[model samples]
Target: MNQERSTLPSIWSAAPPGGIDRSAFTGKKPNKIIPVPHEYRRQTLSRERDMLIHDVEQKTGCDLVPHWDQGKVTSFDIYGSGHGVEKATVYLNHWISNAHTKSIGASAWAKLPAYDPNKWYYAQVEELDNVYKQRFRGPVPSEGDADAPRHAAVVDWPEDIKNTSQEFVSPREVFGNKLERLDELRMQDKVYITLQQSNHDGHWYLEILGHDVVDVELAREHLTTMIQTVRADAAGVQDAHNTILDEREGMEVELQQCEPWWPNQADYVVPQLLSHAMMDKPGSFRQEGLHFKQHLSLQRSIKAALDDVRRRKGAYDFVVRLGCLALSSKTVSKGIIGRTVSKDSFSKQIHESVQLDVKKWLANNEIGCRILHRLMAVKGFLEPTKSGGYFGYTPETLKETRPIFRGTWVFKDPNSSVVATQTSYRHPGRPAPFQKPVEDAQAAPMSLFVIQIDWTDDEQGMYEKGTPTFYKLPPGATGPKKNMDISLLELGESRAWHFALESLIPVPRKTVSPVLVGFAERVRMKRNYDISSTESFAEWDTTLNIKKYLQTGRLDSIYSFGIEKTCYKVELTAMWYPSQQLPVWGLAVRHLEWASHLAELEDLPIGRQAMWLDTISSFLPDDGQSSSNIDEDSDDCGTRRLKVDDSDDESPRDGIRILTDKLMKLSEIVSSVTDCGGVQI
Candidate 1:
């Protein structure tokens, strides 16, 4: 076999540049091929792969086979033969028997086998060394004096280094005078010779035919040059071809040791030195023309993917932050400090802040960093106490307290940062301080607590003469061999409560519905979106447009106060109680009653603006007028006319009923929440 095609040596030292004529090397060759048997199979084809082949052949224009198995290939396979050929005989004859051993074949049969040049072939010339001997008989001369480095055209070294050692002999001495002498040693096509220095980096080491070489200048240069060429050739890049050919033929390695806790160590690195060095030449990494260009493209593809993820995360967080802001403070002041309010004014304030902050953040980072920037925008909204954003935790409860949620508000109080007024019902013995008791779990000495006139009704004389009756907790209990007496009020006094205006309100019970459960699950699966914050005005408003529709239904009247459609054009007149009070009152009821607190307090904690639902059913008028006068479904909205009556210098009976009805509605709403397991009146 020809040595060039035989054992496949590395770094072929061909006959000195022009030492032999080409006519002697060319000869008569066979046009037909005879498949060699049992010496080339590396591994058998998988059944699944064969099935895939059958399917592809039926669907596509061509048949396919596994080109390579592991690292070896079946070089003698004879496919695409005449129909008369025995399929079994052809398959068995071509099967490799011992991939590890060399096979003997006649030299006459050694001529270059016929093949489709368009396809690739693992061609090997048999007995290549013997053929070289027969064709070029004599001692092959060196291309230059012993002083010259082997194949000076392919390598360059410091003159001093080249002359310093005998290993740096010329290519002529290494191969010989006959062209066949060089041809005999040539290995498989496209072989590389890597040289390295061993001791004190002065000794040379060679891996004549293997995968890697030691770290040295010669080896580094050769591998680096080859890598550049392969990368360019494989990618079909052409501009830097000449530049790559001129590189030195030696390797240089800087030993990068992996060390513990060392900043400069190679550990955890992606190992790109070889790739980087190879691509250092200009135009070597480009995809001017080639197959699989997209596969090798790393920068643009990975960056775009990252940017997409960031944008999604950013948009989600932006919505969530908007919710918190929408539920915060009011932009416009109403008739009185605590009397009337333009519906959803406070919530609108929060929503504006969320939108503004997110917009600002997104402006700076643009597309790729969108997700991260949006998250930061949300943090900015709550971290700064613009309108007292609720991260979903109660303001004054341990369960509602979180490092991130605990916020501060500006207040005009000498003793504290913020101060709120409150009213409480107490027994005759308890002092005025009972309105703001400091003791925990200590109940006032009162059997029954009556609400103030403002909280009750004059029409029915309710609470004017006798205390309005409601359910009460009976004290005392027994367990095992002991007797216990635990009162509901005793437990209630210790719980956290929220002050809705000046009235002391109870918290609502937490009820879990399938919808709520699904919402909670969605919240949990996300990396952000805390459950407690979802109930806030900002979150609710930003999350959906339905909330604004809900608010419209609860308004009695919306007067266009500003110039036509200009700023401040919409002025809403509404009479509604605080929605945030429910959670405060609910938690209190649950803990005081000694019932299991099944809910997370953060989920119901209201910020400055409570989450609200404005339904038409909640705003029906109380006047005794006939319904035939107006279309009940004209706009599916509710409105109540506020009527004032003076008779004998006293308010009218109907007037009293209106106020009572308002209170009852509040009670009914509370009751509805309690049905979810909150509390009873």
Candidate 2:
């Protein structure tokens, strides 16, 4: 296969200073592609990206830190995304230092409005390295030199230093071709950790690839002092937090006594030197057990190595710091394309941080949800519209006009039932696909969009869209009405529950009408199943609408042959249409077009996996079943009794009862969590 066709081509952004030439990604013959103008090389981002990056840094203290040292001739790419998730993260990199296999370089980033020190420092460090490489090392070869860190680039005595080395060499002899014969510099048996505190004070490990006896004594003292500094700071911060909590009760006592507390104060601890030099090689020790064992072992090795140096070379009595963590991961592999550290390794720190952030985000959202439930006055689902300006539609009646909608509002009441309190870019439910709309630059998010629904009346009263709200199926009419008489559906149409479909739920093949299923299967299994050409398409034009059955009141059935492995859990709201006297199967299926998050369902822990079950229990206002419970003309979704045989648990009501019991247990867990929140931890 041609290489270009075999792989996804890189997308090019806005054009650069030069007019467009041969596209870098286009698969022209090698003979035709090479020796082209340099302007045509390298991918770039749109101008908007540069502006956004600048705006983010200026408005929010966050910075984007990328990996350095692997300088290939490529343009900068500021934005990246896959699926729906953005790829802005902080990670660690394991690099080759001197002759050691791995040297750790941790990189981190913060989004705007959170000027994280680690992230800012990481970016600044990379920037300095980039400048030095561009100036001293010179522009990369047009085609690019992948074999990097030229012997000359490594000769910088300041950052690349053994300080004790007696050997000396000039950059000219290395890169300038001054030497008649070339020689590769090699480092000797030694290990060193260089902490870059600042540009002027930072230390380096080597002048070239050559190794030498390291100054273990100085290194040990530095390591011990830095660890002590970090540990002390952490302890101090914890102490301050404890002191603040202790005084909270004092405020109550003081209020009783009409007294005032003293001023609050605490020292801010600067972040540790995450950007440092440490061996990146895999830990020489491994035991087939949990991580705590490996963590303890790494600390032991550090301490043991320190003791060995002290015994032989009289280094400081440096104790290894346990319970401390640092980030380091390999970001590239042996391939032409860039490789990265295993996601698990690189994302460990970020994962912890994200979990904490997400928990806080969720907790706040829970509060928001409560406030919204009180404001909206209804508990059914409300999906955001595609437009950026937040709009929510809650169906009132089949008549489109009666549908309740919340729209624009301002500081004061805008005469609408729903009120908008605040407008912000960040929304709590933004993570969900239903609410994650294409962001509108012009729209400011409201603090709260009040539903202003007349829930009391809607719940108790019948839908007011059409008259004759009773079940008198027009005496002698074979059919209720014409197919398009949508308003012919009578009262109790609103007594519906939004059901979240489960993959594990048993769906009988009989749930779907045999005729429809047979036709679908036959059409799908045909030798040329899909119609491509206009001529071929004409042969089965009947297949187009796929909804011809809705007219005959025969559209009384639904089928679930199997779960769509790729799609998310299907959610359907079932209603009893008294005119047709059953759900319009096609109408219920129409809900599938609306976007919803599958990840949300998957994210629930297994113990709390019955979220849908809970929704079903709380959401159902009524399930219209007659005395006979016989569907003479079966049309409703639940026409027949469905059995769930879990250990011979055959009854549907029993299954629901069991699920409800579990829901109560989970509710208690939630209460416990809320109670724990008030107590300081």
Candidate 3:
């Protein structure tokens, strides 16, 4: 594959000055020179150099130029000169000392600006040795010199002391009493120093700054203390909360054991129980005033206990009823399977469901059963239900119906081919060949099946109850009118309960082959599946749709078969025709061969894949063109082969070979995936 190369812009911000050449910097023999006036050039060059030196001094805070006065020298002999040569030479020595100090200071700032005075300075052996030689023995020899010292050091010096020497001296020694002004810059980690040059008149000094290191130890200590205090407080609060919860639980247990007493019951039962106890006391005790007082105190205590029980029981009952109602409403809302129901009817159903659930719960609960038993003794008490048990469909219903759908109703036969084609006969008068009979012809392989149900406008009012009122078959006069009518069938109470339960419970989904999953994924990704205006593409999943139809036996619409080709495409759809039914769902099966090949092409670049598709399509017949030609003289029992015209330009064998290679490659891919824990697409 040939790929196009992209040219990128150069990284340099700007090109070098146009007129300058490499030879100018190297000081080599020039190929060409442009002449200019000597005085003009001299003044311009001098000013530029002066500006450069001034800029460097300002930025570095160091004086590079020497300040000295020199008289005319009459002779080349330096020692015999009598024109204040000694004073000028003294100034020259001061300048050299200042230069050395500046050089060391600049190097220190560049390499270790934030050096900690507490930690002794350390450097490479050769580097320290070179610095030592430069400071004591003068400048070292140039690199070009054969006798240059590469790693020279004092033989008498200790190796440890040489590597860990103090690079910067105390400013107090250099500044004397004047160091007090620079004290603010001095810190435990760093200190300021001055580069100075001394003459007979005064001293020239350049103040060098130091790096500051902020101390965060105190702040860190405060934060740690604060965090510990917060955690301790949280633990204390949690402990108190747990103690309260334990006490509350003990109180609730005591309340559950007591019979709930309502205000109406207190009006009659409380007085009666107290009166009975007082009358049952001994005649002698009843005559004494002290015994009477004791009886009254006992009566008051019993009344307070009953009141407490009533309050707790009332609140508990309210919360339980509210929670059960909410739960039942949510269940009813989500139970919608095929159609929607009306608000009034849906609410009624929710209330009924809640009533049933609450009744069942009360009958089974220990406290609730006790309350009901006590209520049964009351004169006007009427039971909520005669049976006092759940009357709706339960798990037993599901168990009994399990055998009805059992046996070999649906089977998986991997060897069975889904596609079927009719054989053409050459003779018009010849009868079809005899076919072998099978014991069970009704049996069909476990393939995808879709069924669509339609409801009319007259049944629209029935949706308010969450189910259609009536169903009508398509226009056909096959059976008697009475037999064809669904309303004619007498549905028993158990059958109605079974139907309701089945509608509420979702159908069990079946798992599909990975190959089908991969194909569905590709179709979804390509958005190649057909859809109606009422349907949303987002809700469409090929795998999920097929599973739903296989499980629920309900389909919304019938899909177009799409353009026909030589490759097999299988589909089975059943739809009902009604005037006002909702839109039907359908499935569109593309050419199996093309679908499998396209899955493999996913690894290829989009552009290349499209090109390959176009190339292969060119070899295949168009939709308008016949896929295969049949010979009329061919025998019905004999194999029916596609008869290709020799006069055609391209041979059919080439196309077949290409398709076969793709299928073989697909098989290899599937085998490899299966060997290593196959992933579902």
Greater-lDDT candidate between 1 and 3? 3
Q: How accurate is candidate 3 locally (lDDT)?
A: 0.23
lDDT of 2 at 312: 18
Indicate which candidate wins on lDDT.
Answer: 3
**TM-score-superior candidate, 1 or 2:** 2
TM-score of each: 0.12, 0.15, 0.12
Leading candidate by TM-score: 2
Model 3 poorest ten-residue lDDT run: 493-502
What would the TM-score be for candidate 3 when compared with the true structure? 0.12
lDDT of 2 by residue, 1-681 (tens): 687655644333222222212233132111000011122222223332334344433433333211111221111212222211112111100010111232222111112357789989999997776444333222223224453332211212232211124333332322234211111101111222211223685533222211122423333333333333333323322100000101111111110110011011111110111111242211111111113432233323322222121111110111100011111113222231222233233235333331100000111223322322222231232222211111223234222111111111111111111211122233465542111122222322221111111111123222211110011122223322211101100000101111112111111222222223223333311133221111111011134222332222111111111012211111111111223222211112111211221223323321122222122112110122111233446575443333221122122332232322222222222223333321011
lDDT (tens digit, per residue) of candidate 1 on 568-661: 1111111112242111111111011011111111132211111111111111112322121233564634222211111121222232233222
Q: Give RMSD (Å) of candidate 3 vs. truth.
A: 44.7
Q: lDDT of all predictions, in order shown?
A: 0.22, 0.21, 0.23
Model 3 lDDT tens row, 364-474: 122222322332332321112201011111122111110000000111211122222213233556565222222323323343311112221111111110111111112
Ranking by lDDT: 3, 1, 2
Off by over 4 Å in 3: 1-566, 570-589, 610-681
After superposition, candidate 2 runs with Cα above 4 Å error: 1-76, 79-586, 589-608, 612-648, 651-681
